[model samples]
Target: MWRYEKRLQYPVNISQTNPKLAQFIISQYGGPDGESAASMRYLSQRYAMPYDKGKAILTDIGTEELAHWEIIAAIVHQLTRNLTPQEIEESGFGPYYIDHTTGIWPQAAGGIPFNACEFQSKGDPITDLFEDLAAEQKARTTYDNILRMVKDHDVCDPIRFLREREIVHFQRFGEALRDVQDHLDSRNFYAFNPAFDPGQKPCGCKKNQ
Candidate 1:
């Protein structure tokens, strides 16, 4: 039930080709804290969330993560476009070029392919929300690392936008975690899985009540 926008969440227009920079940036495309993992994690966890507010938060943020993925992919594609054999060899992109010449593939800077093991959907709302919060921070740090190596204004602009989004998502997830915590007994928040074990009544501690 999603519609095509025909536009990126953030525009990417890189005038210079830097295969080395592309190698580093590609990590965010499929790295552990990458957009693909973030989107999948939140979208999958939403199904087991116990509250409507939590579910909505996960759903909206998950969708936004997909858009972020598109932005990252565009950056990588633009960075690697119109490369020459000499540029590939000089820029040390041969290893990647041999595998997928100038093509966008999900892999870490070291060439580890994207894997589902990077994220978890624990089904427990608290656990999943906490994971979401951590994921955003991890992504932000990754962007920080990228900004340190990149000097292109065009490249940095969209990346900074993505980095800022990580902060905003982290805040939203913090709020969602608080909302979930409010429903559980503070003394024993882990007493039961809110997404399951329906018969176990909440402890109704003073803090939660």
Candidate 2:
């Protein structure tokens, strides 16, 4: 049985609106590199995980991603609300305004359409964990770019929060990788893979220095 926590991992508040920025930010909300895919990918893959530790990692990370989604949505809402038609036209948000009227969508910053092919769930623990590690790095980079582009404090606050969470998720996935290695028999761990070794040290999950 899974326990549910409704609280966000971090708080999000938007004090003002900027339609142009809102459109760009909403791209990540549902976009390829977005939080929605991150959470769904991990949570969905948990069904095929063979170990409890792996399942737990998926559950935790997935839950955190849900918080991330909320933060992005909050930012979008704050940035897009109450825009005059002239302001929308001046800001080049007219196209989006015409379609959704301040609605959130998952297109790219450049207005490219979002696609689900951006993420995957391979079911193999090693493969999936490796993908997750890479995904976190990608998301961190995206947040960094967003921060550099936006000047609003309200927007940057949640973006910074989301970026730091990526680093933490990367570290946790690294720990999960070690957990996977520890589950394997040493003598046979690298027997099949001749290109590299699985390393000598077992997982160090509890003792963080």
**Could you tell me which residue pairs clash in candidate 2?**
none
Model 2 Cα lDDT, one tens digit per residue, 76-181: 8778778898999999998877877887777776677767787898756677788989989988888887888888887788788889999999999999878877
For all candidates in order, the CA lDDT equals 0.92, 0.78
What does candidate 1's lDDT look like per residue over 105-158, in tens digits? 999988999999999999799989889999999999999999999999999999
Give the C-alpha lDDT of model 1. 0.92
| Per-prediction TM-score to the true structure, in the order listed | 0.94, 0.83
Clash number for each model: 0, 0
